[model samples]
Structures are given as structure tokens and as C-alpha cells.
Target chain A: MARYSILVTSSPFTSNGGANALAYCQQLVRDNHTIDQVFFYQDGVFHANAFMHPPSDEPNSVKQWVAFHEQTNTPLVVCITAAARRGVLSQQEAEELGYNAYNLLPPFSQTGLSDFFTKLHDSDNLVQF
Target chain B: MATITVRMTTPPYQGISAQDGLDFAMAATNYGHEVQILFEGEGVAQLAGQLTPPTGMKSHTKRLKALPFFDIEELYYCTQSAQARLTDGQSLAVAAEPLSADGVKELMNSSDHIVTF
Candidate 1:
């Protein structure tokens, strides 16, 4: 099975890219393919925002991503530069930046682009959305 | 190290995709991977010569010109896309080769990984 590294570069609500990436990941899991990582960059960092609250009936893309991570044990990495620029900060990052609050959700860690390249080097394929 | 191709389809300055794609390409090269950048669709605008960004906008042309310094020498643009968008007398700022559809297919097929922006 091919190893895949996924890149999400669009906002979760503004576009369906995040949801579509999740579906692709699910299909990969069903096919027994290995997922090396799901790297979020640019506006895609919004996928890890813990403060997002949609209507109860609406689909929560962040929650769905977290669930996918749980099911597949795949790493969800958000680019720290992009996340910080968009206010999607982890507790440590918020503290470092002197923000009183942080919104980066669990199961999603903030990292540099170097980490993404390292993972991409190890993967057989890279899929972007 | 892997041979990676980053295919850009977004126009420059309008969104962060163009900048992000260039940044990713540089980062990949820094990590000792082979990187090729392909500009297609609206992305071909990124290589247009004599681009002048509005006040407060970063100069994409300058950044693109510095790609060779980062050791990313393989640059390609879709010939059809450029012909459709660029009027007569317009030219590319960077020294990128024009690729037909088949050439683009070969580039993607030969790369170990393909990333689109």
C-alpha cells in the first residue's frame, strides 16, 4: 500500500477541502494504506481551532478530523507560522505570544514546515486540497 | 531524498497560495530534496516579468527570481496557459521553460511526489 501525506491549505468553513481530505483519509484507511501525516498550512490551520462552534445539526469539520486521527492514529500537524498568523494557537504558543487564551485543538500539534518536508520525504505520495 | 513537484494553479497576490507554494518549494530543497515548480492555469501570472505589486504587497517577482539561489533550478510553466493569459509583448521574469500538456504529464509521472497549490 502507498504511504500518503496530505496537505490542507483552505479554510475549513469557506471551502469543502478539509472535509474532502477527511473523506480521502477514510478511504485510505479502508484500503489499508498508510497515512504518514496530515499537514495543515495557510488558512487550513483553522481546522485545529478548538473554539469553532457550528450549529448542532451542522457538520463539525474539526471534530471529524479529530475522530479521524483517533481512528487511524495519524498525526495531524499544523504549521506554526500559519497557525499563529491566523490566531490558531496552542497553549504554549499563546503563552509565548502573550495571548491570554489559546484555541488549538487536541490531537493537532503545531510545527514548522521542516517537519512537513521530513514527513513528505518519507511518504510515497503527497495529496493536497 | 525524493523528487517532488509543486504544481501551482492560483494567481499571485490575490491569495497566500502562491507564496505558500514557493515557501514549500524552498523548504523542500533545504531538506535536501529535489524540487521542481510548475506554474499552470492562473499560476503562470506569477512568472510574469515587470510585475509591480500595490503598496504593502510583497513582490512575488523578486522572490521567484531568487529560486535559483535556493538550488531550485527546474521551473516549468504551461505554454497554453501563458498564451491564453499573457498578451503580446508580455514575458516571464524567471527563466522557466514552457511545457506542453504531455510534458506536464511526464514531469508529474517522473516525480516521486506531487503537491498542488
Candidate 2:
């Protein structure tokens, strides 16, 4: 299986960007490709927010992502700089920043863009959406 | 040798994507990685000269000049798009190569990594 990384840079609800990434991840695993990680940057960090509760009729992206992670064990990482500026905080960061709310979804880690380049070293390809 | 192609298809001032894309190319160069910057679609406008930014915003249009110094030199703008939007007598601030549609595909195909912004 070839190793791959995915970059999600757009918000989930506003567009199909996040969903498309998720679908690709699922397909990748089904195709037997190894997903090194999914790096969420810019406005894309919103996919880490567990607070999103889309209407029952509409597709729930985070649910799909969480389930995808469970199925593939693919790691979800969000850029800490982008996440902080957009108000999606990690557990420790929310406490440190004195913010009462933290919406970061579980199984997702807050990381730096430096980690992105490092991950690229081992990843065979980066399929950005 | 891994050649990374960074496609800047977004405009400046509207968001940080354009600036960040440029930054990635610079960083890739510093890390001893080969990178090419393609200003396509709306990104074609980012290279135009004589931009006036409303106070406090970093002028990305002007920042293109510094890119050559960083050794990230293969600056490209789409020929079709540039010909359409760029007004007569206006030129890009950077020394960029104009790529045709086929050229765009060939460049992307040759690159090891294609990062779109």
C-alpha cells in the first residue's frame, strides 16, 4: 500500500470540501492505500470541532470523519495556529487560554505546520482537497 | 529529487491562502526541496503591478519580487487567464513564465508533490 497524506483547508459545512476529503480517505483505505495522516489547515480545522450538529436530514461530516478514523485508524491532525485563530481549541489550550469552551473533536491532535513537512518525508503522496 | 508544485489559485486580501502558498514555496526551498509556484485562475491577478492595499495589509502583489531572491524562481502564471484579465500596459511585478494549458498539465505531471492553494 502506498503511503498518503490529505490536506483539508476549507470549512466542512459550507462546502463539500471536507466531505470529499473524507470520501477519498475511505476510498484510499478500501483501495488498500495507507493514510499517513490528514492535515487540517487554514479554515479546514473546523472539521475537528465536535460541536457541529447538522440537521438530521443533512449529512454530518464529523460523524463520518470519526467513523472513518475508527475504521482506518487514520490520524487526524489540525494546525494549531489555524485552529487557535479560528477558535477551535485543544483541551489544554482552552484551559490555558481561559476560554470556557473547547470544541475540538476527539482522536484529532493539535499540531504545527512543521509537522506537515516532516510527515511529507515518509508519505508517498499528498492528495489535497 | 522531489519537485513540489504549489498552485496558487486564490486571490490576495480576500484570505491568507495566497500568502501562505507563497510562504510554503519559500519554506520548501529553504528546506532544500525543489518547488515551482503557479499563479493560476484568480491567482493570475496576484502578480499584477501597481496594487493599492487599503492600510495595514501586507501587499502580496509586491511580495512576488522577493521570491526570486529566495531561490524559488520558477514563478508561473496561466497564459489564458493572464491574457484575459491583465489590462494593457500592466505587467507582473515578478519575472514569471507564462504557461499554456498543456504546459500546466506537464508541469503538474512532472512534480512529485502538487499543493493547491
* TM-score top scorer: 1
- lDDT, residue B70, candidate 2: 74
> Model 2, range B3-107, lDDT digits (tens) per residue?
899998887776788877877777677666788899899888888877876588788866777887778889888898888878766767878898999999999
| Model number with the top DockQ | 1
Which is the leading candidate under lDDT? Answer: 1
- Tens digits of per-residue lDDT, candidate 1, B1-117, equal 899899989888886889888898999999889999999999998888787887787899999988998999999999999988877667779889989999999999999888888
Global lDDT of model 1 = 0.90
lDDT of residue B40 for candidate 1: 95
Residues A86-115 of candidate 1: C-alpha lDDT, one tens digit per residue: 889999999998999999967999889999
Residue ranges of candidate 2 with Cα displaced over 4 Å: B30-32
Residue-level lDDT tens digits of model 2 in A16-120: 889889888888888999999899988888888888888899887777888888877898999998899889998888999999888885789888876777777
What CAPRI grade goes to candidate 1?
medium
Chain A TM-scores in order: 0.97, 0.95
